[model samples]
Every structure is written in C-alpha cells, then in structure tokens.
Target: MPASAPAQPIKLVIWDLDDTFWRGTLSEGSVEALAENLQLVRDTAARGLVHTIVSKNDFAPAEARLRELGIWELFVFARISWQPKGPIIKELLSQMQLRAANALFLDDNPANRAEAQFYNPELRVADPTELPQLVPLLRASGQPDPTLARLAQYKLLERQQQARTQYDDNLAFLRDAQVQVEFREGPAAVLPDLGRLEELINRSNQLNFTKRRVTLPELEASLRDPTRRWGTVRVHDRFGDYGLVGIYCLNEAENRLEQLVFSCRILHLGIEQFTYAHLGFPVLAVQGDVATELNQTEKPDWITVQAASAATETPAVVATPTGQQLRVLLKGGCDLGQLTPFLQAFDLDVAEEFNFNNEHQIPVHLEHTLLLRATREWPAAEQQRLAAALPFLGREAFDTRLWEPGYDVLVYSPLMDYTQPLYCERATGRRVPFGAYQDITAEPPAALAARYAQRRFQGMSEGFLQRFAREFEHEGPISPAEFQQNLQWLRAQVPAHVPIFLLSGAEIDVPGSGETGARQRHELMNQALAEFVASAENCFLLDVRAFVQTPADVTNNLRHYHRRHYRALAQQLAQAIGAWQGQGLGHSPWADLKARAVGLLPAKLRGLLGR
Candidate 1:
C-alpha cells in the first residue's frame, strides 16, 4: 500500500539504520552503505531537511559506522540504542524540538513503521522500498540552503542538548549560556530575507500566534507599507547563530500585531515572548492555540536587543573602537563555555577560565569565592600540599587568571558558591570548595571508587577515597551572610575601574529532581546576591529569574535550561557590558555569517578548516 501524502512538509527524516539506511545489520556483520540513500540525505540536508537515526544497535559501533560512511555529523539526536521504536521516536521528536507531523520515518520493517505511527498519529512513515517514489519529493521539501545553514543550526542545537544533560541545574546552565538577539528592520534589512519571512508566515503553526498567511508578493508589499512595522529576528548564543529565526509585523495604525511568526527551531528560547515585549505587547488576537502565551506586563530580561528596533525606546549607541578589542575574562562552570562564541560575536576579546579535568582525572572547579580568597591569602606551602595531596585539587587548582592585569572587564558567575559544598581540611582548618549537596565522605569507599571508575577518573581509588573521607569534613553550601562578605572582598580585590558583571541564580523548583529545597536555597542566595550587587560599586546583576521562572523552563533541575535560553542570556550579558562601557559593543556581521557558513562546509572540510 502506498503511503498517503502528509499534511505538512517533512522537516526531519528519521532512519532505521539496520536494513533501511544500509544493506545489513552491523551487529551481525559488516553492512553495505546505500549510495542512493547517502545521496538523498546529502541532497535533502542541503535543502534544509534534517536527518536522524533510530536503530536497535549499540550506539558506539553504529555511530562509528556512520562516521566511516562520512554522514555521522549530518544527523542530530540519533537514537541508536536497543529501545522500542515508537516511544523512542516520540521522545526523539520532543528532544529535537520538532513536531511529529513535520517528520517522516523510513524503516524496512512494517512493524517498526506501524509502531512509530501508532506512537505519533500525525507522523508520516514509509517503507524503505518507497525511496524510488519519494526521492524527488524529499529533495524538493525544503528551500535551498547553499550553506547547509539549517543543518548547522540543528547540529548546534544537538551540541547544546548534549551539554544541557551535564548540568543538574537548568537556571545555572542558562545563566552561563549568554544568549543574544538582534532585530533588523526597514526594507533594507527585512526585504533581503523575503523567502524566510514568507515561509515563517505561511508554514509556521505552533508559534504562528496570528495564523496569518501571506504570499511572496503580499509579504513584499507589506514590508513596504508605511502603516505596518516589520522586523526580522536573528539569534546567536554560546552554541551558534540562528539566523533570522523569527518575523513580526505590527499594524501601527491599530496598535495590533498583524503577523507574528517564528520557526520551531527557536522554540523555548523565549524569543516569541521577548519579541512581544519588545513590541510593547501590541494587541494580538491569537487565532488558535499557540505554543507560547503572550502577556502585556512581563518582559524577558534574559533576551537583550542587540540591534535597536524601531520600537526601542532608547537605542543603544554602537561604540567606536580604539583599534583594539576590549579584553573580557569569563569565569564560571565549564557550561559557561557556551558563552565564548556568542561573546566573541561582539568587539570583545574573550578569555575563558572554566572547570576542567586535571592530570589526576579529577574535575576541578576554580570559580569558587572561597578558592579565590585562598589563591590570594593561603600560604604557598599550604596551596602546594593540598594540590598534591588531594586528587580533586590538582597542581593548578589554586591558579587563576583573575590576578592578571591585562583584561579590562570581568564576566563572572558565582554559581559555585551557590552550588558547591565546602570541605574543611583537618590539619590547617582551610576551607576548600568541591562537589555539591551530597556528603562524599559518608559514602562507602567501594561505591565511591566504582562511581569514579565509571567516569574514568584516576587517582580516586578505594584507599584514596578512604583517606579523603578521613581528612576532610563537608561544611555544606556557603551561608548568605558569608557569601555577601566574600563578594565585598572580591570587589575590593579587583581594580575599581573594571566593572564586574555577575550572573544570579534561578529560584524555580524542579519537581522530580532529587535536590529537595533547592529552590528555597536559590531564593535565599539570590537575595544575598541582590543585596551585594545593590550596595557594591561597579557591580551589576544579570538576574536569570526574569525569564527562567517556571519548572517547564528548566531541564533536569533548577540550573539547566533548554538551549535557546543560553542565546538569550548571552545577549543580556552583552547589553549589560555595553551599558557599563557607555556604548554598545561592536558587532561583527561577517564573523556571525562566517560562523554559520562554517557549518555548511562538508564534514571533512570543516574538520580540515579546524572548525
């Protein structure tokens, strides 16, 4: 039986790797790569269609085979484990931030396709034998993406999702992400992206608040109309750039939004809410149930306006550079590493000093305020002895770039103080920051060592774990009063002229997350942070609670958030930095374009280019 035509154009192609993508099963023997299938993926991907995998094979070998076939990186959110096809496909779509209707699953097994359709009633599924009939339609699905920019954006989202899992706290992840948005208006700007505007207006459903559809000619005319205010939204974060992901048109005469639409790619980043707020919450008569609800009062502070829109009350002044980039030192968890790319988009020289696995294979976090004080006040002998004795604190544990004088500004997150527990040394009464919540000393050495071994951490043997338990006592998280005092000390330590931009913690409860009373803890700490920032000179707070409010806003815990939030956080950081400097940071359009273009290159070529 022939598969019926889908109601929506296919944006994603889910493959069954065993007999569908290749000739045979990898678990049994070597499988032959299908040339036609390979060509179809390459061609459709270039046309902005995404591809993924759903296979009942070991992830490692299957991924290795795909890489060998030179198409591994082309797919996002690949589910290769031995899981039920139906549930996995449903979850995969949710993770990819895509809808079932916009995805097509191709499998060799009739049972597998039926299971997928059963799980997702709107999902379109077909047998692998239908490729000959569906090839042209698949190739013709998406618009031309010469740079494979859409594929690259999905890859960026893939990297972000991978990173989000590492964090236990969703708000913490978002605060470190550093998301930014640029709104471009006028015919000179919005007209060039006419095709994207048309697609977003007509095809977008979930985020298409107004449900307004317009043809190319109609859109072109609307852009030129004096009665309408039109704009395009471009976003970039620590992950990568999402170029022109949204469009908005307001009927100025009636103070209503005529057309408000965005690609599902930018979902959960609060782009739509931010855009509505940016437009002063114009009267938008929503046609149907939309993914986001627009409110008149709340404006998402996480998202910063990079380019001034016509609606901006006070336009930022783009700074004239002095032939040199402002040196910025970003210090936080390794998760903040996402902010580097987005921060570099501005006229700033970014330097990252994040947590890393030391030579002992123990992950060392150096961003703690207690550790910062130790770096300055602790005797050299004490520092060296602790660094050598403790696997958690390697030789470089006490070392930091904070003392360096070259950097002009400091972008810091004091989340370690909010999350990490303090361990006091028995001999010298010196306090050290390590781990979070759980008392590692209480756990059996065998169990602790086994956990460490699973993580491939060396030097954390049973004997060493026993010794660590004996020598150090867990002191719990830092007290708010002590936290404030430390902040004062840090302010005194840094040069007064250099402004310190601090990121505050989110205070939302994540129900299933085992961290009981974490929200209350964050609330207490947030208050302490706010008090410090209010009184302290040259200190500003980037409060994440402004946007990361609901449980749905986070992932596993209160600290980690969806990828889009990171882009919004980056923009807020840039805007705050600009305010401190009395001018907006110089944006590199070519740098952003180059970043997107780099994704379009072939995987081999991208690796060769060292991207």
Candidate 2:
C-alpha cells in the first residue's frame, strides 16, 4: 500500500531537545556539548529532514542563544513555555496539520512521551539520541514494520499493552521500557538479528536507551549458555546503510525465542516480517504440544514500590517547619544533574551563596530534616575555561583551566564511629577497607571513645592525614610494606558480612611535560592501591590513586557534582542503598529512603528534632 503523507508535507521535522536528543539533566552542561547537539540537529535537517524545535525553555533568552549560533531559522515553530508539553505538542501537530501516525514525536522524558502517546497512540516516539538511525523510517525509503503495532499497544492500542486510565505502574513501566534485547546474529546463520532486527531495537525504547550503548559482555555470555543461541544481523538495503539492526536469543529446551528485537528506525521497509516464515518462526501462538507456538519475547523484572501515604500517619507533635538561618556554600562543581531533586526530597529552600560569612546565613524554611553537603566530590575548577589563556607551552589545541577531582570525604559519620569506615568505592562497585581501628568487640560507647582517643592521636593529626592524602600520590609516610601490614591487620578485624572499601586517591601535577609518564604512573598508582588494600585484613582497597589523581572530567572541585564522575558514583550509591535495604538496614528496609529519612530521624535522634 502507498503511504499517506501529511497535509503540511513535513517541511520541518521538529524535536524536543532535552530528554529527546540525549539523556541530560536540564539544569547544566557544557557549551561544547550543546553546540554539538545543535550541529547534529542541523545535520539531520541537511540530510533532507527539515528540523524544528518545540521545547519548554525560557523564550527570549533561549532563542537568543540559538540565534547566536546561526541555526535559529532551522526551527519553523517552537512551543517554548513552562506549561505541560502535551498541549504544546498537540498544538504544534494541529498547526502543522499532521496526523498522529505521520507525526513522529521524540522526547527523553517518559512522562512526556506517554502523554503524547495517550493523546495520539499512533505517533512514533523516540529518544533524540536515536535520531540519526530513525530518519529513514519516516523518509521515502524504509519498509512496513509490525513492531510498530506493539507501540500502539504501549500507547493504548489494546488491553494487554495499555496503561490503566488511572495509572498503576512504576516498576512495570521500568521493566517493560528498559528490558532491551538485541538480535545480532548474521543472515543464513539461523539467528534472529539477520537483516531487519537491529533497526527495531534501536528505536524500541525512548526513555532508557543511552546513546552509543553497548552490552558486549552480555552478548558474549549468551554464547556460553548452551540453552540459548544468540545472533546479530547487519543489513543495508538499496536506499542506505542500516548498521547492525537486529538480534535474536532463543532457548532450545523451551523451544522459545527468548529474545527477538529490532531497531524501529528501519521499520516499514518490508523487513518487518523476517520473523515470520522467512526466519522459520511462526507469529501466532502454539496450541498442540507447543510446537506451533510463536516466538516469545524476553520478560524483564520490575521493581516493587511499597505503598504508604504520608496523609495516613498520625501527625507528630514536633514543631512545624520554620524559617531558620543557616550557612550555605555554593562551591564550584559540575552538576551532571541538579541538586534540586535531593533538596526537594527533604523539602527545603535553597539559594546560591552571596557571601561566605554569617551574612550569608540567610533564612531557610527549616524542616524536620536538613543535611548540607559541605564537601561533595567535584573537580577543582569550573568546566568552561577561557580558551585563549591556556598557558601550556606544549603543543595542544586548547588548555583546560578546570578539572573535576575526587573528593573522598564521607557524610557526617553515620551515627556511629566505625573502626573501619564502610565506604562505597565508585570504582569496582564494592566495599573497601581503610584506617587502623581493628576492634569493635561490642564495647561500651565510653570504651569505644577511649579506644578511639588512643588511635586518634596517631590517625587524626597532620602527619597521619597528610600521609593518608599523599598515599594517592605515592608519597605516603607509610612505606609500601607497612601499608600491606596494615591491610592484613584490617582484614583480620572487619566483619565478614560487611563490604569494606578502603580508598586512597591521588593527585598528580601534570606539568609542562607530555603525556609520557601516564603508563608508569598508572602502574605505580595501581601498585600503591594493591598494597593499600592487600594490607588490610578484611577490607577491599581501591587504588583510585590513578583514577582520582587526575583532575575531574567536570569543572567542580567537589567530587559529588558531575565532576569525579558524579552520576556514575551516584548510581553506585543508589545500588549500595539498594543493597543495604536488601540486607535489612531499616524498619521497613524497603520504605522510601527519602520519606523515611525525613520522618524517622527525629524519633531516632531522641531529642534533637528540628523544625
């Protein structure tokens, strides 16, 4: 059947920039990344796909910046506003005279995509990162695809796939949206991803698929599983190149196609039905001895969210939230994501610091909980430095004035002074061991404090702290052998159940010298790390000496900001929290951490409740 084009002829292919183009925190990023993004948009338009923008941004200032870049005219229409995007997108579609199916909607945020899908189930949804591959499907080239039939279900095509009108999923949404399977098998090789599968998977998910994502290990592991046969297909039709576009994973015992997915970008090219008789799989269900069953898609595990309404709990007799003065410092750093979500979780007012002294202690609406991050991990400098002042005498394109560094400071000692602090290392995704305190014999608090005093004299001073800090740079006062001895001692002391992470980061002065010493330094850094941890009795030591020794990738000096790989570390923290919950760390262990933190701390503190 010939396709029906929109009345407007789609002279422009408009897109939402934030979550659509790439997964990014709307609050911050570098000018360079933003420039590359705009260039990508223009390039897409240049490739015969006219592009436009209908995003939610501050109008005058947003357009002014785009104009400065000389690509403002690329977008024929922009619904820039603070209102909900559903109406905005609908308005654009109506103004452009386009039907839902003909109109392709791209957004990074799942809520926005769902809203558009709810309004018009037939429209195609995608992540902006998938744009380069998806343009073909909308163009005059690609063939008809049935994977799209499932998308209609995701947006309410049928009872099996539609969201309940009232909304009853968080975990289900994640599992369904995030369970990605690729068919990478070659053609004539008897695997699913022969020719057309890769295209379907590329555009399968809009919310979770990161750009340039690769799960090489998982793909390789499937080969060792005799029960499963996995394959990927690379295809290119007469029109253009279709990079590795399909994958297939099947379970021989179950006689089930464990995984069969393709990129949606190349759909409608008549390659959709390769899964049918062409691939030797039936599309319909089996009834007799399961021999006639169709291939089954992979099922994903979903997270379970325990329900608890704040309104149902009895009101505590504590004082209500009150305006109180507090000191805040806006230390420079890279914020891969905004700090607002965390702050809002605690329900507090925040503002930038104007001065560092008591004068800066502006009044904040004090809540029952208030925790300030005095020292977050970040780079030592801002991300964007003036290109001209790069003082490097060596041959280089430009100099970076700022770098994000690792800040290994801990949150205010968690209610207990542990002999060996339980730190979660960003590297290795495991616990590590550090320090010299070797015993926790159920001793009284007084006895523990006394024991701590003796160690404090040796561990807390300038000599010890300096030496500890220098361990990363390989100038620790403790010798290599002594460090190993300490590690053995620590290993003997720690509890087997705990994951101990002992970390010693480094900082190197990258002088005018070239990048020649990096390898040797890497080896030294690795050795120092191995010795540091190997010496500990029961702790895992991460030789982040080399890792943190270099300045941060972000501009912030604090490691918590997007500097020192903040998001990656945050994920580790999240996992640790998940692990902690799994280990039964709280009353509800699974109760919402943010909610419980705000509600339980006051009771746990006995008398220090704040309002």
Candidate 3:
C-alpha cells in the first residue's frame, strides 16, 4: 500500500493442472504419461518464471507423481495437499515470501483462474500447455535469467525419490485420510464468491467434473432461462474448503430433458447430475400427461403413463470415475473380439451385454460377454460419439465390448457407463516403437515369461514388432461441438445413467513458440481437449507420450507386458463405474489385485489409499 515500497519483483509462476495447462486429470495415468508437458516447464522456468504446482490432492501422491514424472524441480514450491488451492496458493506466496504483485498464478480450472483473478487481478493466469508461447508473452520485452535451466537435472532426482516411496502403503494412507464432500441444491445466487469458485474449479478434481465453463454472469443468465433448469452443488468438509463445486444445466422440451451436464467436481456427492435427472423426470411426466390430454386416444404402444413407477426407478444413469452422471441414456461402445481375451487375462467371465427383465424387475447391469458374433458396423453417430470422448475412451468403449454393428459386438448396456477404460489405442501418425509390452495373466510371471520365450522363438522366424512401430502424429484437435453432440446421443440411449470418458494427446515439435505438432496452434488442441473431457464425469485425456498405454490382449502388443499393469487398470475402471453401485464390474480379480498391491505398502500409506 505504500508508494515508497519498491514493488516485489515478479518471481514465480503457479501452475494448476486439469483444464489450465493440459486437459483432464493427470492422476488418471502412470508417471510416464503424467509428464507430457515436461519440456515446456523446463524451458519456461529457464526464462526466469519460477514454477509451482497448487492442487488439492494429498501431499504424498502428488509429490510422488511429480517425482515419478521427473518434473518436480521445475516447481519452486508445490502445495499438493487436500486444502483448498486458493488459500494454499496465497500461503504459497507467503511461504515463498513473495507478494501477489510479484507472482503470476496459473491454473487450468476456470474457477481457479477466475478466483485467482478475483483475489489478485494482476496475477498471470495460464494453462500449463500454453507455457511455450506464454513465456514469450511474459518476457516479450526483454532477456530472462537462465538459472532455472540448471534445475532440470534435479528433477530426475525428485523422480527417483518418488519411485522409492510409491509402494509404501498407498491404500491405508488414503483410507485413513478421506475427503468427504457434501453437496446441496440452491439457486444460482448461492454460488461461491469468485475466488472460492475459482479454487474449487482448479483444485477440485476427482468429482463435480464438467467441461462447459460459463462466466459468472453467463452462468446466472443460463440459470434464469425459462425453459432451462439449473442447480448448484456446494462442497464443504474437512480439507480446507471447496465452496460451490458443481453446476448442472438442462433444457426441457415437450417432455424430454435435453442438454444435461454438470461440473465434474461434485460428482461423488450425487448432487449435480442426480439433481438434473430428477428435474428431467418431472418434465417427462408432464409430457405424458399433455399427450394424454391432447389425444384422448388410447395409450400408444410402449408402456406409458407409469408415472409413479418411473419415480421409483431411475433405469439409466451414466458416470465416469469423476462422479458426474448424464441425465440421458447412452449406449456404451462394444468390441466383442477384444472383450474375451481381455477378460480372460483377468480370469473373469463377461456377458455379451445386458438385458433388463423390466417385468421381472432386474436391476440394470452391464453384463459381460463370453464371445464375439457376426461383425456389425457401428452407427456413424456412435463412432463419432467416442472419437469425441478422446483420452477417456477406455477398453470398455474401445476394446471388444464396443460394437461396430455387424463388424463388432451386438450386446448393449442399459446406461452407457464408462468411468474407467482398460486401454485406449491410437495409430501413431509417425514412425517406429522402441518396445511394446504383451499382456500375460492367469499364470505366474515366470510361466508367463516362458510363454513369451516360446512366442519369441516363433516370432524370431517372423521379426521383432516394435521395430516397425513409431511415434503417433497429429489427427488435429477434437471439437467441443463434437463432444456436445456426443453427450446428446448418450442421453438418447436410455435412462440417463451413463457417464462419458474423453482422451486427448499433444505432440510438441519445437517446444516454445506456442505452435507445435501438426496444426501448430498450441493452446487450441489442449484447450479443446480440456473442454471435451470436462464436459463429462471423471473424463480423461491422456498425453500420447505421457502415459504408457496398457493393451487389453497380449497379442495386441508383441511384447506381452500385461500382468504387472493390466490388472490395475481393470480395477480403476471398475471402481470408476462402481461409483454407481449397480454397474461396473468387470470382475473381482482386478479389484483384488489392486487391493493386494496397496496392501503391500506400509499401513500408514495404505490407510491413505483408495481405488
């Protein structure tokens, strides 16, 4: 406040993951995948912008992930605990002993970015993926100190230390420390202050997820629409405080609920999408009455006017691990050929699809499949639906369970639920692979190793597989309209119980310049990717090089590297789907393996872990 006080030198750049820099939650992948933007960070810091990470995860996992990815050194300070990132960010400035004027805060969350701007209008907000061009924007006027360059080597050490601590009981550690999120329905006016909302958006990952970001005024106007129903989800409990973490928007027409989606933050609270679903059901009931009154005609074919029966049963609800479910029913993709071998490796039985004996009253379940039949070509709408899903397109959607109509599986899930996926495969636009692992389950590692040897003996006659592979190229960034349409199709399938998953990958050719890869427009691809993933619950966008892709079938990849990792993915997918309680469920072995792995850690760490 004093004119005489020399302004504190702008010394730091705070980073928020999720929608800020890259798209999707980084925690959803392996360390290899999480560090997709490492080069960008290193170069930025070298230009004198001090880097830091501010997130809402427990300190241990966040720290471990950073270290595993070998990017820890780029951050001068990291506040990765369960505290609301806004306050932690303020504290970070203090701890680093810097002033708001001297530090530029960055994050991918609209709320976090908005809140940072609200609290400190001067703070520089950014998406980590935009750093290449951003640095020039920051230093367009002059030269910068290069001391940060030396910090890169230290990053490797951080990763080494993280690798050392990873297995020390992650589950016990998580269970012992739980983040209980509570929610409530309220008028739009109840939204949190700008700063608080920003904190929630940026730091509140894992639940209340959404990709559609509207400015506060835009949010209010949308809510005020006569034909639109809006609901707000407030989050609070234990870890600092994340206020107003979720929002759902739906348009009601003749008797149908359309355009339903909510923030991904409060997904677990069941307050956002559930509220939207509840709202849509009433409109549907009203429509039925209108039809009866207008026609006075005998009730049409399909079971109609079972108003009370409908209220008691929500047949379809889609969700991803992020917690948000759709108000519309979506058909899950089916790939029959991929499902059998994938499931076999895990030693689980899968039905081709699900059948609801509404008369007998069987709860909706995504029955697994045992075999593949005649190939049915998938509808263009469905194919387009998933391509829009991006990184979150898991094995459930990408593997055999996903049908291409006559060319694919024939089974159908009641509500398209894609919380987790086994693996997402994309043909690289580029040249050769270093090595690809083959999946081997149902046998000890040694026995599997023998199988590999036998396969190798046979393969030697053919050739090495990785030798023919190469890095992937740019298919160009996916569009938001593509995703919006995908959401609408998902709603049309059944009762709105399905959740959608999205994935995106970025390629950095010449790191900085903000233009890289094929299209060369830096932020466009990442931003579009973020928006797409955010539109769904627990959506994921994997960096092509960031996370290692785990193949569903051993033969899918020549190396046969399945068991050490394949089972873990199955559990993650199952848990994401399991959030809904009635679906998910590939098999228990994957879950059991995951539990066992966590059990192997120290009790303290295990106490803090969860699927």
TM-score of 3: 0.25
In candidate 1 the C-alpha lDDT for residue 595 amounts to 45
**Candidate no. 1 TM-score:** 0.50
Candidate 2 lDDT over residue span 78-128, tens digit each: 667777776776766654434565566677777777887776666666666
* Lowest-sum lDDT 10-residue window in model 3: 286-295
True lDDT of residue 376, candidate 2 = 16
Find the candidate with the highest lDDT and give its number. 1
Off by over 4 Å in 2: 1-51, 54-221, 252-255, 282-611
* Ordering by lDDT: 1, 3, 2
lDDT of 3 by residue, 1-611 (tens): 12122244445667665555345565675323434366656655544456777875566766766677677756755667656666677666554434577666666566776776676655656655555555455553212224232233224323332343554764333333233333322332222122223333443323322434444335434544677655444433222223334544456555443322333322223334344444444332221111012112232121112221122221233223453331211222232222233333332333444223222121222321111111123554654453343211222332343432221111232111111111222442211111112222222545544544564322211122222112132222223333333433432332233333232222233323222232233234334344433333323322222222323322232112234333433333333333333344445456565655664677578657631
Q: Give the per-residue Cα lDDT of candidate 3 at 608.
A: 70
What's the distance in Å from true for residue 374, model 1? 66
Whole-model alpha-carbon lDDT for candidate 2: 0.36
Q: By TM-score, highest first, what's the ranking?
A: 1, 3, 2
Model 1 lDDT per residue over 339-366, tens place: 6666777888989899998997878889
* Local accuracy by lDDT, each model: 0.79, 0.36, 0.38
